[model samples]
Structures are given as structure tokens and as C-alpha cells.
Target chain A: MTTKTPEQINEDLLRPLEGTSPRYLAALTFFVLVVLAGAAAFLHQVYAGLGVTGLNRPVFWGFYITDFVFWIGLSHAGTLISAILRLSNATWRRPVTRCAEVITVFALSIGAMFPVVHLGRPWLAFWLFPYPSERGIWPNIRSPLLWDFFAINTYLLGSVTFLVLPILPDMALVRDRTTGWKKKLYHVLSLGWTGTPRQWSRLEMAMRIMAVAVIPVAVSVHSIVSWDFAMAPVPGWHSTIFAPYFVCGAIFSGIAALIIAMALLRKFLHLEDYLLRIHFENLGKLLLVMSLLWFYFVFAERLTTWYGNGSSEMAVFWPTQSGSYAPLFWAMVVCNFVIPFPILAIKKLRTIAGTVVASIGVVIGMWLERFLIIVPSLSHKYLPYSYGSYRPSFTEIIITVATFAGLAMLYMLFSKIIPIISVWELKAGEVTETATAPALARPEQVRAD
Target chain B: MASVNSIYGLFADPDAADRGVNALRHAGVAQDQIVVMSSEPHEGHAFSLLDHKTIMPWLAALGGVVGGACGFLLARYTQVAYPEPLITGGMPLVAPFPSAIVTYELTMMGAVITTVVTLLITARLLKWKQPLYDSEISYGKILVGVLGPSGAARTDLENRLRSAGAEKIKTTGQL
Candidate 1:
């Protein structure tokens, strides 16, 4: 049997579709329009300040902050899956790793911006950074808000590095295959990769090390984000279980985002053979697990608060269970826990379509969960005298829409530059004995089983 | 100068590159000279014969220490310099718990940043220079580059590589 060289394999893998299709152009146009609308809304928010939001004395943290946490949570899915799977040597992870890593980068970028947007004055946001200025006073180190600045920045840097490192060889492939502008782009990005054994060894070692190191940081980043609420002295806000609760919620939302992304890429890029039903099935199982964990945490936190019968806590709990926010609360429960647990439990319901529905539900549910966490506690403060209702203004709604649009636009732009799938890893896995061994068996022998 | 003769290189399926590396060593190639390269970083068991060392751990640890120190200094110095500090619930000037949060965040930040920077530096990235690379390597090929002396010996080495499933063998400028 003749073995193919690396160059031959790359040509076979990438030479299929070299030019832009009509569908791609249409998608790009739509993405550009959404982004412009978002930019306009963002500019309005800048002009109006925090007055444009639904925030007040009590309910200061609203949709922008919640969405910030939500996006950060979504970012975790990519890094967690890529890093953990890479370390474990899970061959199935190859087709999805690049997309997963890219999700982390884009989500982090979008998520990190929310804290800045949430600030009353967007211009003074640099105060969070430790820069000596004319003013003698520094930002409070004791505040969890400051902790978020450091945690998020670190997570973002780590994720970008993780995403870029593995794509070097693939970029080299693109460099060789294209000409003119695309060729120049890939050539600059490829960084002189010769696939020399020494370079490969160092690259592999670095990635392995990063895969192991990044997991805890990803967990910590979100946990610190959770602390922004938990550290507050407010009745419903201060809870011990908030860290794990937020982490599970984050993972649940993250997996949903991953499913959505995977589905889109599979459709657009024609990656049916690589990203198969088995991949979706595994992801469905993960979503189910996160759903149950979220339910358990939510239940446990509520049960303790209800049993304690603290008047202050009861005020917050009543709104969530049977008061103004009750509908959103119940909807969150059904979407996050009830719908997912039953539907995802069955193997047949774990199909791509079923998983997509469950994923969408979980995304909506997770959003409500964040709202429930932020709003009720603010609406039912300890003093009760200061507590007031929050009605999100048009500016807040438009800005929120813009953030979502911006996220989609970033992802759309990324797909154009990098192959959504890690071409090298996918091809590498394809050429392996383990990858090829299944084909070597006789059909009769395999059918006998 | 005594000229070296034959050089043999072994190539394997991307999945079994590590195993092939082991087998090649068992077949008598020196650990120092044999090189195994692949698209993904499989576990090191595949390259046990070769020295596998990395500077990331050291860099990460150093970053953690520096970050921790900076965090402590930031908290401690701020408290010392501010004559009239805002007291929350009559708490101590230097609360250990809050300070711990600062330390933990900075430590993690340092470690992660160092790991990322070290990876880029060690990988020799962003140089933007082009090199001779077969694009098929991205399509799941494991390449083992080996060097040996001229003529008949090189031919024998080529035969070994061919038998071991090495494809498209070509010599580099005299090494």
C-alpha cells in the first residue's frame, strides 16, 4: 500500500472548494447589516449613559450584566471541550476542536465588553486596570468587580493563545494552496512552519501543557464572575452555592451555543462526514447532565432559603415563586430543567433536530435564569423601602440586540479566515491506523455481529 | 573526515506515529537523531525514546509567584498609603479573605498569561517567513526527518524508509 505525503494529503483535504459561494456572500451581507445596527445602538447607549438602561438604585445589575455573565459562560464550552478532549486523546474531538476554540475567543471578546458597557461611564472603564494616574486613589482591591477585570482578561488571553497555536499547520496548508491576497494572508499567519520535528515537538508540548492549565482558569473566571453577585450583602444575592450554580448554568448555556454553532458549520461547510450524528449525541448527553446539575443547585439554594424562613429572603423568594417575576422563573425552570431532562433522556430524542430544540430552549432558559438571579433580588432588597420595579427602556433592548448581533458577526467573519474545522487535526485523525482500521474489516465479518 | 553513510527514517499513520517511533528505536535508531512530528500532540508515550522537555511549567510557576507578590503589594501598599480608609462594617484594614481573592485572581492571571506567551515564543510564531512545507501534513500525515551520509548508504537508508512506509522521500541540502 502506498502512503500519501503530507503535501498530497493537504491538497486532497482543502482543494475541494477554493472560492466564495453565493450563499456565503448573502450570509456576509446579512451579518454586516446586523453589526451596523448593533454599532448604532451601542453609540446611543454611549450618548445616553446608564440612564438608557433599566438600572436604578436597587436594581443596578440588569440585562447587560446578566448577558455579560451569560456570554462568558457560553465561552467556556469551547475551551473546556477542546482542552479536556485534547489531553484525554479523544479522537472524536478533532473535527470540532477548532470551532470550539474559536467560540471561546469570540464569546470572551463579546462577554468582556459587557462589564464595560454596564459601567455608568464607558470612558472611565480603564479605572479597573491598575494604572497610576494624577489622582492619588486606586480602584478598590476588595471589590469583586475588580477581580472580574483580572480574571476575564487572563481567560481571554489564554483562550486566544489556545485557539491560535493549533491552527499553525493548517494555516501553512492554506498558505501553500492559495495565491495572491489569500496566499499572503496565510503566509503571514503560518509563521514559517516547515513541520520540522523540533518545531512540532515544542508546539505539541505547549498545547498539552495549555490544555491541562486552562481548565481551572476557565472555571475560576466564571466563578469570579458569579462572585460579583454572591459577594453582595443583598438577601437573595449572597449565597454559598452561587459559584457552582453559575458554573453549571454557564456550561449548560455554553453547550447549547456549541450545538447551534456546530449545526450551522455542518450545514454551511458541508462537514456531514466529519461532524456526524454521534458527535451530536455525545453533546446532548452533556447538555442533559448540565441541566440536571443546574436544577439541583437551584432547588438546593431555594430549599434552604425557604426552610430558614428569613423574612428578607422570603421577600426575594416570593417574587421568584409567585410574584411579578414568577412567569419568567417558571419558564426558566421548564426550559432549563423540565423540558431538557425528559426529552434528552431518551436516545431517539437525542437526534440532531431534537438536540437543536433542547439547545435553543436551554439558551432561552439560561437567559431567564440570569434575569431571575439579577432582578428579583434587586426588586426585593432588605430595606424594602428602596426596592423599585425595573422596566427596561428601548435603548437597553436595542443595545442588547446589538450585542447578540455583534457576536454572530464576529463568528461569521472568523469562519471566512480560518477553516471552522481544524483541517490538520481532522486529516491527521483520518490517516491514523485507528481511523482507518474500521474500514479494513470485511463487510460479512462486521455484519455477523 | 569519516563520512557517515546510511540514514533511515520511519513514518506511520498519524494515530500510530508514537508507536512507530518506539518501534524504530527498538529497531536501533539513536534516540538523539530520530524525530517524530504530527499534527496533534498525542501523549508522550509515543516519543519516550526522545527527550521530551518543555519550559512552560517553569514560566507558569514564575508568573504565579510574581502575580501573587504583586497582588499582595497592591493590597498592602494601598492600605498603608491611604490615611483615611473606608471601613466596611468595621472590618480590619487588611482583610485576609478579600486579599486572598486578589492573590488568587492575579496568580491565575499570571500563570495563564505566561503559559500562552511561552507557547507562542517556543512555537516561534508570527515570524511571517515562508518555508518548504508539504501541505498534506495538515491532512493527517506524520513526517520523520532523518539525516545520513552520501551515495550508497543514503540509497540503503531510502530503501528502509520505503519499506517502513515513508512516502515522497527527498534530501535536504547537505546536513
Candidate 2:
């Protein structure tokens, strides 16, 4: 219920884009250097062949594939959540939608790079495309990997359009307010937006359709990623529950990522008033729900696997439960469930700091979840003689770390170029709030409700 | 491009803009001649209802159909047309289920891309010539104006907008 004029909102939101601090530069430079190091490692790997990494006969899909799934799951943070919130007409979503959508685009882009990074022959990666080639062979349309190529590409395109549609007016606002090359740049970016009623109406309509259209695309993207494992007939991965489990875990981790990103933006960008306690409380409740859902999926997957007692499945199950991978398994449980469950479930403990703690745990836990799902199952495949354990080499580790840094750097640079918060959406919300119930616009009234 | 004449007035509030629209309409401005613009959508207001019923949804559906066909054919024809079709994962060469996934993704992409293109075309965005424009629209002001009104009609429209509580009135051509 913190009321702000459109002018104040614009000034506050646009302030971050106007200038750079030494801290921002230092952070960007650090991220870029880390990314460059990752690139160097990737080059080394490409030159040295896939043997430089941890891949063996059995555990070929190791850190890179795990990173791929984790990042793609993390990408569910933005477009899916934002679309749902917009469709649901969540009033608190005004300040959150843009940041959330930005995460999806960046995270998805980074996630999509892993398949290329992990390729034995990176140059031959274009074979994944559907084009007719000189070799006279088309990619197998039936492969889950091909489905992934289509799904991720579609989601990325859909997400970019989703993010760009709402940014037009904000760009126009910047175009009008600034001068020189910045103005020229924003003018081109804005595409001659005049904010005519027709334009606004059409934009709103398009957003509505996108919100509806993108949810399934997002769902299908993660599900296809899961199928990449499930279709393999590996002991633990070949399950009917893998698709929904991955999708739920995706939203779970995605929400956690969103919370952490929002917290950082609030602290660093001075969006304290805009990203309020109520927003955190609401998102914390969502995190709690997803955490429970994630736990349920894990329990259901395990309970059925353990009860069925198929020797092949148990081969993968025992190591994850009480054998070599037990520590990581229990840690994943603690991070994804035990620690977050109570913090998020308790109202008093679900403050910004509390949620951030829980979110960090979930982020780590989800990464572990992806790792456990890929590695343990591969290591314990039914053939005992072919059993192998994978440990990531320096190259894999550096590239993995680089992807995280790359996402942060992209987000940082994007914030500088575009208003992190949607200015006009806030204004629109304010107008609606003032018009519908002026009395409810009071801070005390809003708090009591 | 020739400089088309336009007269516009900026109003601080939407109600005033609505009133300005009403005044212009009362002063015999054609429905198509009147143009209203604002930074945010003012749905349910008369100003926002200008040609509001659009063919965007239909066109998007058509795009989806076209994309679906292209995707289906791309998957089926490409696999079949290959001199030696490789049956993957024990599935048929022309796998319906997998083809459906490709079709679904392409259909959504087609719809999304078409929606944006339709919005741009229907909203008349990216025009090289700036039609009636005022920077104040970005400052939470509503612009009410007439595009290509006759020289004799310019004074009448400006007077109506001014009397209807326009904070500022502007002209882009000789009046």
C-alpha cells in the first residue's frame, strides 16, 4: 500500500539504469573474467577431447548434463511463474514480473549452451538441427534430445517475445526522458512506440495470449528435459513420474531462484519499498507449497521404487539411499526439504532473510538433485561390470562455475540496459488501485487487510 | 514522406482526456480521425475502445495452424524423405507422438510470433513518420487529438480540447 506517483515510480525504477557504480563494474568484471576462464576451459576440453572431463563408459552424462537440467529447471523461475501470476491477476506481481521473465531468458540461454559444451565433437552440434545436410541424414525426430532442441528453442523464442512485449513502453519512456545516443538507442529499441490507445490495447491482448501460451511451452520444455533421462531406460531415470517430478522440482527451484534474485535486487538496487515484505511473505508461502510438492514427488518416487524391489532399480536405489551417495542424498533432503520446510512453513520465520536462507538451500539442493538423478543412476546401471563413478575435472568444474557467473553477468548488464522493474505496469496498478477503492489505498487499510 | 497535419492536447488525467475525446466527437470529429494515446492502458474508457475489436486472435490461430502443418511435414517428410530412414528408439520412422511434440512447440511459437507481428501491424507501430505525438504522454498524461483534420476544423478541435480541460494544446501543421 505504499503509494507512489507515476513520476516517482519512473524516477525510482529508471535510476538504476542511468549510472554505474564501481561496485557494479567490479562485479561485472569479476563475472566476465570467470566467464572467460570458463571459455578457456571449454576450449581446452574441445582441444583435448571429451577425455579432459569426467566422462567414462557408463557415466558419460556427468556435470554438463546435470548443469543443463539444473539451469533449465532454474529457468522455470520467470516465464512460467510470471505468466501464472499475470493470468491469476496477482496484484503484488507488478514489481516482480519483469525480473522473473529476465531470469528465464538468461537462465534458459545459459542452460541451452551445455549440450554444446558437453559435445564430443562441438563442431558437429549443428547435426541436432532439422536441416537437410550434405551427409544426406536428418536428425532422428524420435529422439528425446531432438524434442529438447525443439522445445528449448521454442521456449526461448516465446520467452524473449514475452519479455520484450511489455518492455516497449518502458523503453519509450526512457527514449522520451533521455538525450543523445541513449535516446537514439532506446528509440530504435522502442520501435516507434507512441503509446496510442490502440497500441496499449493490442499490447495487453498480446500479453494475455502469451501468458496462456507460454505456460505449456515452459512445462513441456522441462518435461522433455526429464524425458532425455527417462527414455534411456536407466534404472532410476526410467520412471513414469520423472516428467512431473522434474517439472515440480523445476518450479520449486525456480521460485527459490526468483526469491534470491528479488532479495539481491532489493538490497543492491534500493528497491526496498517496491519489493516489500508482503511480496516476500507471499513468495515464501509459494516456496513452502512447492517444497512440500517436491518432497511428495521424492517420497512417491522412492516409496514405489523401494516397494517394487526390482533388482535393477534397487541397484541405483541402494547407493542413493545407504551406500556411497548417501551423504549427498541426505544433504539434498536437508537442503530441499528439511531446512526449508520449517523455515518456510513458519510465518514468523518466513521473513526476507529467512526466505533467502531457505532459497539458497533449495538452489544448492536442486543442483544436487539434478546431479544425483544423473550420476548415481548412470553409475549403478544394471551391468555390475560396467559400473563407474564420475568425478568432474577442473575443466568441467570451471565451465560449470562459469555458467552461473554468466547468468549473473547477463542479468547485471540487462538491468543496466533496461529498467529492471516495469515502470508503466506499476503506474497502471496505481491507477487501478486509486480508481477502484481510494480508501483501500491507505497504508494502514492495506496492512489490516 | 509528407508531413501530415495533426492537432493534439495533453491532459493530466484520463477523465479530462475522455472529456476531450467527447468534445472532439461532439464538435463533429470523425471516429477514425480522433486518436487517444497514453503510457498505460485505460481499458473500459472510451478512448481505449478505438477499433478495439481486432483480428489478432484469428490471425494468431491461423499462424498456429500453418506452423503446425510445417512442423508436422518437417518431421514426417524429412524422416521419410531420407534415403534410409532410421527408426529411432524402436519407434516408427514417422513417429506420431514425437512429431506431435515438435508440432506443439512450433504451433505455440507460431502463435506467439504472429501475435506480436499482428500487434505491430494493427497498432500501426514502427511507422517512419511520427503521427500525432506528444512526449507528455510518457509523463502520465493522456493525449487526445485528431489526425488529418481539415484546416478549418483545426481551430474548432483545439478550442474543444482546451475548453475540455486540456493542460496543453499543440499543433503540428498550419492552422
- Tens digits of lDDT, candidate 2, A1-449: 34777788988999998999999999999999999999999999888898999789889899999999999999999999999999999989999999999999999999999999988899999999888767778888888999999999999999999999999999999999999999899988998898887888889889998898899999999999999999888999999999999999999999999999999999999998899998888989999999999999999999999999999999999999999999999999999999999999999999999999999999999999999999999998898999999888988999999999999999999999999999888878876522321111222333444
For residues A106-157, write the lDDT of model 1, one tens digit per residue.
Answer: 8889889888877778888888877666666677777788778777877887
What is the Cα-based lDDT of residue A249 in candidate 1?
Answer: 87
TM-score of chain B of each: 0.65, 0.90
Best by TM-score: 2
- List ranges where model 1 is wrong by over 4 Å: A1-17, A431-449, B1-51, B78-89, B121-175
What tens digits encode model 1's per-residue C-alpha lDDT throughout B51-161? 446777888889888988888888766655555775666667677877777777678667767776776677666566423334545444666644344454555555555
Model 1, retained fraction of real contacts? 0.38
| Residue ranges of candidate 2 with Cα displaced over 4 Å | A433-449
Q: Which lDDT value does model 1 have at A91?
A: 79
TM-score for candidate 2, please give it: 0.96
The 10-residue segment with the lowest total lDDT in model 2 chain A:
A434-443
In model 2 chain B, where is the ten-residue run with the lowest total lDDT? B42-51
